[model samples]
Target: MDYIHLNEMEFYGYHGVFAEETKLGQRFRLTLSLAVDLKQAGETDELKQTVHYGEVYGLCKDVVEGEPKKLLEAVAEQLASRVMEDFPLIKGVRVLLVKPDPPIPGYYKSVAVELTRGIFV
Candidate 1:
């Protein structure tokens, strides 16, 4: 098994439970890992034989920057499901979503949610 990872991809979006949060918007970071068999691509040296990371990045960007969701879990879920559906070659996917500035009373760095989807075969 081989992994393709996109770490700390940033986006600005309106996604939160509070009305103020939705209106003001904030920065979010995402990390995505795709599991696949790289034997064919490595041997053949063909782009088509492996997952196209550029396309995967575009898909992640679209999910992060598209519709607003009340929870980071929803965002992560949607991204993982979409990736599995769109890229059938990928056996599994892991998504990590981070909100650098959460709407909270205390001083904290960030809040995050991690989700994994699909089956390994």
Candidate 2:
């Protein structure tokens, strides 16, 4: 299996369990690993044979910055679902969602959720 990686894509979003978080919004970081067959792209050197990076980035932006979900899991699920549906070449995806600021009283860099979805019809 071949992979296309998009790392450290950042956006502003309202996603958390606290009211302040939903109202104020915060920064979000997404890293995606797309499972695709790049044999054709390598052989033919055609953009059509592989996924378009801009389109995927746009989709991620739309999803992450669009709505306020209570949990990072929901955001990841939605992203994974949309990616597989929109891109035929993508057979699977790894979605890593990072929340740099959480309301929790803890000392840490960030909190995150990662999910993998694949083999969609």
Winning candidate number (lDDT): 2
Itemize residue pairs with steric clashes in candidate 2: none
What is the C-alpha RMSD, rounded to one decimal, of candidate 2? Answer: 2.0
Model 2: per-residue Cα lDDT over 2-88, one tens digit each: 899999999999988899999999999999999999999999999999999899999999999998999999999999999999999
Off by over 4 Å in 2: 119-121
lDDT for every model? 0.90, 0.94
Evaluate model 1: give its lDDT. 0.90
The candidate 2 region of ten consecutive residues with least summed lDDT is 112-121
Could you list the CA RMSD of all candidates, in the order they appear? Answer: 1.3, 2.0
Each candidate structure's TM-score, on Cα atoms with residue i matched to residue i, is 0.95, 0.96
Give lDDT tens digits, candidate 1, residues 2-121.
Answer: 888898999988899999878999999999888999999999999989999989989988988889999999989999999999998999998989999998989888999998887643
Model 1: which residue pairs collide? none
Strongest candidate by TM-score: 2
